[model samples]
Target: MSRPRRLLTLGHSYVVGTNRRLARAMAQAGAGEWEVTAAAPAAFPGDLGPITLQPEAGERVVPVSVHGAGRIHTMRYGPELRDLLRQEWDVVHCWEEPFIVSGAQVAAWTPRGAKLVFATFQNLPKRYPPPFSWMERYTMRRADGWIAFGRLVAEVLGARGIYDRRPHRVIAPGVDTTLFRPDRDAGARIRSSLGWMDDAAPVVGYLGRFVPEKGIETLMAALDGCAQPWRALFVGGGPLEAEVRAWAGRYGDRVRIVTGVAHDAVPDFVNAMDLLCAPSRTTRRWHEQLGRMLTEAMACGVPVAGSDSGEIPFVIGDAGLVIPENDVAAWTREIDALLASPQRRADLASRGRARAEAEFALDVVARQHLDFFDNLLMETR
Candidate 1:
């Protein structure tokens, strides 16, 4: 039998076990065909607090010290990474932005025989300043291929000509179906805890950062204008927390704003919702890359409604409703329509779950990545 290919993946996000699902899934999916090792930081600063590396069973994970721990642009791996890179690898996959210092370091140290691929979520084209631009140039020059987190990301990077003549694929992020699938009992428990046991109103949820660009105001307005009875749950913390709390105060028990919910407990909150809304508004420099919440909700068999901003429409596709980013009236109308018809909600939930399984499930995404890597290795040989 031929020897299995060695695959090494490195990323800061892997410090969290949930974010390491891709690597774990790949290892499982490619068993007997490939050997996968994931490298993550021992500790990194998180939004809520310091996050220690949480490795999962059945996956080969190595915890390495990271300099400038929380800072993506400036962070660099410790000497252990240098030794790891010196080892033989068939593929080196970097889950960092190509314009960052860590990315350049990876590109520079990757063995010449190995195919190095970088994954990115930057959906906008911008002329990055000084060292970042230099770093991007060096990394791209060395990269054997690249992966875009969304269609818009591929389009933007392709148009920039940064990846001209290089191979790239549009691979969306994955969701753990086992962790996110429908759970009515869990939903009931959450509702009961929220003092909403008697309320039959459909729950409208927003599950990302509570920032202005997320269109929190638009969601609040839509809730106000919703002709049908509804409950609201905003899960997450950000600069707009105080404002969200103040707004939720008006509805008393009808609305709940939950901050600091850990990633592992997010499924409970998602299950509590009848529908999830991602009303992201685009700004000059930033727009939604891919609303991972959409996939998670879909995986949970929850109907989703999102704005047409950036990749939301692409991510949602035909599985759920898509409203204009800033159209409060349209948002109100569509949300009302969904809430009014359980049939529509059920249909969307069914379609969304199917979509999640077909496209965004962990194993499905892992297979896609392995295929890409196989093709790259074949072409190079």
Candidate 2:
């Protein structure tokens, strides 16, 4: 009757909606099967809590940070990990950059025969180092496992000698399909709230961190060039607040950029748009992880158009139009095609919804996690 040997999932950015949504999915799916423990980084502004993994069962664990990655952990980085490995978890799952090494370190710290897992939830190519990490090899070196959200990460890890030949799990991160599903009457409410010009004006939208790497400037430039009467909506916030606001100011009434809304409000905003635009650039800083916004938008049955960089091609498959990163001409043409031909947009919407359910639905993604957990544990036994 004891819980199946308490599996611990430690990661940073757990407070973010993307991570929280994923944890909630795992919790709902695993339910009585496993006691899920999650760890997150220090509280930031608007962060709900330091240790939150589904409804405060308090199963969540937030260990102190020691020499952790990022700007804050300048010196004592990777220090607090001793506590994590000392717990001797059955598996250690890390999210994002340094955590792969962090999890690898934890796995190495554990007694022999424990499983190690690390996932790249964000797009890797977007913010890749000048020289990609040979250090990553060392981080994943001792690990016995990996889970990539898309083929992008899968290919990277596979090349690193981490994903091949072993028990590979392809459980992608998911959106809240329940919340993001098509709403026949959502158009009025969202438009009214935003003071948008009736249902006639084509509204292009995006939801993500407001960093320069997101290619928002390119989006703004394209929006200016768009011949058709159009409006663009931007959601979410991040480090590059001043630059984003400055761009929005120039457009005045033409652009409706509402920065920093609650994460839960994303679906409402997403459902209001006719199309989701991700004009991400292939920069030294970021290529994109998986573009969670792309999936979330499609889940609401909205059409999607994005750059062909990173995991977008892997995620969207045949669902939407994929264009070159900085191609304003392509954006203009694609937008024109969708706005002029409702049928094509409808077709993409249908394919997008179907694709979301098949690959990124919370239930589907959660079950995949559980099944992988079961299989990995069985192998261990």
Q: What lDDT tens digits, residue by residue, belong to model 2 across residues 162-237? A: 4465566766678788888887567557777777656667788878877767777777777767777777788877
Task: Report the lDDT of model 1 for residue 231.
Answer: 93
Model 2 misplaced stretches (Cα beyond 4 Å): 1-5, 41-89, 96-101, 121-138, 162-166, 184-187, 238-252
Q: Write the per-residue lDDT of candidate 1 for residues 1-381, one digit (tens) a residue.
A: 999999999999999998899998999999999999999998999888898987776779999889996677999988888889999999999999999999999999998999999999999888889899999999999999999999999998998666966899999999999999999889899999888973579999999998999999999999999889999999998999999999888998889988889899999999999999999999998989999999999999999999999999999999999999999999999999999999999999999999999999999999999999999999966
Every candidate's lDDT: 0.93, 0.69
Q: Which residue pairs clash within candidate 1?
A: none
Best by TM-score: 1
